[model samples]
Target: MTISQAESHKHLIRTKVWSQLRKVALPDSRFHHDYSSFIADFEGSSAATDLLVSLPAYKNADLLFIAPDNCIQALRYRALKDGKTVLVTTYGIRRGFWILDPNEIHESKWEMASMLDGMERIGRHIALAEITKLPMDIGLMVTGTGAINYKGLRFGKGHGFFDLEWAILYTIGKVNKKTKTIAVVHECQVLDEELRGEVWDTGCDFVVTNKKIIEVEDASKPNCGILWDKLEEGMLEDIEPLRELRSMKK
Candidate 1:
């Protein structure tokens, strides 16, 4: 983690740009109200349905979880109750601070303990390794974001966990072309414009909001190959959870 490496970190720059853009209210957010209405309109939309129940195709998935928001709620509650295993990532607020929830489905609030326990109740409990590494032990991974380009992801503002999670999974030999990852957001989150992306961000295979199950084209996936040679040493350290995980792995 030399100073030179820090100066050249593209992810940091992308994060800064995203933070700036997020305040502008991109065109995608315009659909937030409409998308939310659609979710309420459809009888079988993912979010409005039982959070725990599995659909036909997504049934076999090892993991199926959604981010908690005004748009899509975590379905793990219904999943665990239906006797299925689920995984969830808790929100981070401060230094080395993470709220781990196991059975987050049961608890109404979004925090670490409830989310972790709920996931554990159905099966293994996992979270995005941070904005640095991906989960290797789990078969499925899930997340949500503010907006998604046609390829299925946009820079996550200042939160680096999404990309970091994918990179770490690649390091541990977990994610690949075949890996199934999904993002759930309100329909307003889908973007048609190309979001300037760095070589480190991990794109999603599927984007699900309240209205539809969007299967993005493969060519749109950013950072398809691991840039192991491009591993910015200090950049990883800049993201605290990654540093901790690396230490534990050591």
Candidate 2:
């Protein structure tokens, strides 16, 4: 498909998923509606998060970099309660990292650390240099795909935060071949169609929903490091963490 065709296809898929999710009525969920899309923070988010933590890879992973998304809160909370270290990034890595170390947090406060704002309140603010110094394991990434094929080909929101976050970890040698990447979304988001992503994009090892988990066999994950040349103007100046990482490369 041409670039325009691809965009139209993605918009259609994303719109369908968002519309369906909005129609869902759940007392347990808190919806965030703004811009052209909406994020329904469904009760199933907990169910899906539970499914992810139950994975053997989740148990084995010592450190994880989880997205600070509303849907991903459960994973962050569970990881901390289980004594695993979590690294959370602000929107686009603009605000750097919040290190959620179970050992450092009081047991009662694990729930607080899971919330997007709570991490900044209670967790340690980790510099890019400090985080790059440690080893990271499996990443329990938050997925916001409009649709994805069974092979785990994912097309997410237009923003490329997840891709850039993975690049930073991979570049620092923190994430290695052993690392497993996973994303949990609603079952409706799983599509039979192959919606493609850019060259710098990475596919998940597993696509999990509250109902079941699908292992992606096709390896479309990006092999090289960050796509520095492809970044939008002033990206290096705007995101502090990326800037720190770039200076290290120099």
Evaluated with lDDT, which candidate comes out highest? 2
User: In every candidate, how many clashes are there?
Assistant: 33, 0
Put down candidate 2 lDDT per residue, 163-197, tens digits, no spaces.
Answer: 78878877877775446777777777778877666
**Candidate 2, residue 205: how far the Cα is off, in Å:** 1.0
lDDT of 2: 0.73
As for candidate 2, its clashing pairs are: none
Question: Candidate 1 — what's its lDDT?
Answer: 0.46
How well does each candidate superpose onto the true structure, as a TM-score? 0.55, 0.89
